[model samples]
Target: MTTIEIDHTSRWFGNVVAVNDVSMTVGPGVTGLLGPNGAGKSTLINMMAGFLAPSTGKVTLDGKQIWRNEAVYRAIGIVPEREGMYDFLTGREFVVANAELHGLDAAAAGRALATVEMEYAQDRKIATYSKGMRQRVKMASALVHDPSVLLLDEPFNGMDPRQRMQLMELLRRMGAEGRTVLFSSHILEEVEQLASHIEVVVAGRHAASGDFRRIRRLMTDRPHRYTVRSSDDRALAAALIADPSTAGIEVDTTEGALLIQAVDFGRFTALLPQVARAHGIRLLTVSPSDESLESVFSYLVAA
Candidate 1:
């Protein structure tokens, strides 16, 4: 099986460091490059795609160096997040152009378009296509070479529900066939449903790497912050503060809510309603304040 190895790699743009010293192995199977926006995911993907060179260490395909290597293109295919395309060309023409670059013909392009379910709209100009359609056509262009390794950066960004599922199934099948597939995504649910393994980056740092469930557990176990509104905010805060599960609670006078920090997630969740009932305080609104993927990633980085 094909494997991509990143060894202590780092990339810098003048004074700004994009990717920090990070090392990870992407073997045959679907691996998710997970992180919020501006977490160096695109920088890492560009390095892996041989479009950018690492400033410090190495990025290799199997045993060969990927940077400035022309031969690696035969084994690698990339679906970039950027929307640059031949606007005047039809979908079929765009894919065929990519195919010809690999010394292939229209037959290969036709098969790729079919694989991405874009044959019906192949005659339409790319400028006339929707964002989702353009994304699929770019995927077709990438697949036209039938490479053993596929690298997709935010592949589901513009896809609708059905298009998302179709691409997920295609990646899964490719991985099942022992082709190395790596796609970057910020959405937790997308990664949870599509990737067999996940590599998480935060603030240009490699924060975690493992199965989705394991990563999910880490996120779940972290200290969670929540906002709670009750009929008696002060009374609810006083009761919740007495519990060991709650790390801290601050009554926000402006919002008329209690900002709670729970160190023990399970215990705090179980104790909240019980405490509210015992104190005769009616809970009105309970919501997690830091539920964004960005916050989750930040928590992992802190851990």
Candidate 2:
């Protein structure tokens, strides 16, 4: 399996730094690149695909320099995020052209289309295809060369639910085959479902990298803020504040709820219900106020 390494890599555009000093290794597996829009994910992927050079440090594939290296393309397949494909060409024609460019034949193109389950619509013009169909055709074109490393950017952007699941299954199978599959997406659920490993980027910086569940647990282990509404807010808050799990509590009169900060996630979750029941208070709502991925990532960056 081929491994892509970004060692102290940084890319800039004059005064604007797109990718900050980042170092990571992408090995064989389904790895998700998680970041917000304009977080320099595309820039990083460009450097990996040998389309853009880093301003500092190195991007290497199996110890070979990726920047200014055309030979690396033999082992790399890229599915770009933009929609600037050749619209006039049929899907089959498009894939065939890509195969030819890679010194491959029509059989390779046919196998790729079949792998993406797009052979049924391969004869149709790309202009007449739906967004998901176009995505599959693009995937077929990328896979025509049978590269070991596959890089996809926002691959599920316009796919329907079924289409999205189909593509996810395909990626899973590819990862199982030990192909180094790295995909960039801003959607948390997409990464959570498909990626065994994830790298998070925020504002051009590497925020976190690990198994999603482990990273999620790390995020949750921090101070947790919750909003709770109960039949007796004052009584509930009083009882909870006495517990060691709770660090602070405030009664928000405007919202008729208690804002609580808990230092221990597991202890607080178990303690809250028990405390409310003991005081004969019925809990109306118990919700984490800072459980969103964005909030979790922000907390991580702050730490």
Candidate 3:
């Protein structure tokens, strides 16, 4: 099985650091590169795909250097996030071109197109294809050489539910065949549903790695922030502050709510209702204020 190793890799463009000191090993399996947009997921993927060189450190495939090495292309297949395609070319023609680059023929391209289920519309111009269809064609091009390592950046960006399902199943089969498959995605549910292991990136830093369930537990255990609006805001705030679970509470006059920081999730959840009932405070609105993926990633990075 093929394996890609990123050893303390860092990539910077001028003054901006795109990928910080990040190190991770991608082996033969489905691995999800989970991160929010602009968190350097694409930069790291480009390095793995041998499209970009790291400013520091190295990216390797099976201990062999990947950058500027043409030989690695035989084992590496990439479906980039960019939309740079030959619009006039038909799906088959495009995949055939990719095959020719690897000393392959039309037969290989046909097989690739068939694998992606794009043979039905193989004769159509790429300009007429939907985003999902384009993604599948790009995937076909990547598979034309029958690569051992596949790197996809946001492969499900424009795919519908059915298209997503089909692609997921295809990737699962490839991983089962012992292919090293790594796909970047910002959606948590998408990653959870597809990958056996996940590597998380937050602001160009490697935050967490390993089983999705354990990483999810770390995310859940992080301090939670909430906005609570009640009939008796002052009384509720006073009651909540007396408990060790409530770290702090700030009265937001503009929003007519109390912004709360809860340290112990379980304790705070159980205490809230009891405190509210005791104070005769009817809870009008109780909403988690920092439930975004970015917030969760930031917490993980800090931890």
Tell me, by TM-score, which candidate is best: 1
Candidate 3 lDDT by residue in tens digits, 44-133: 999998889999999999999999999999999999899888989999899999999999999999999999999999999999999999
**lDDT of candidate 2 at residue 272, scale 0 to 100:** 90
For the record, the alpha-carbon RMSD of candidate 2 to the native fold, in angstroms, is 2.3
Write model 1 residue lDDT over 128-233, tens digit each, in one string.
9998899889989999999999999999997899889988999999889889999999998899998989999988899999999999889999999999999999
lDDT of all predictions: 0.93, 0.94, 0.95
Off by over 4 Å in 1: 234-245, 253-255, 266-282
Query: Using lDDT as the measure, which candidate wins?
Result: 3
Q: Candidate 3: where is the Cα deviation over 4 Å?
A: 230-254, 263-284
Q: Each candidate: how many clashes?
A: 0, 0, 0
TM-score for each of the candidates: 0.91, 0.90, 0.87
Total clashing pairs in model 2: 0
Candidate 2: residue 275 Cα off by (Å) = 5.8
Judge candidate 1 at residue 128 and give its lDDT: 98
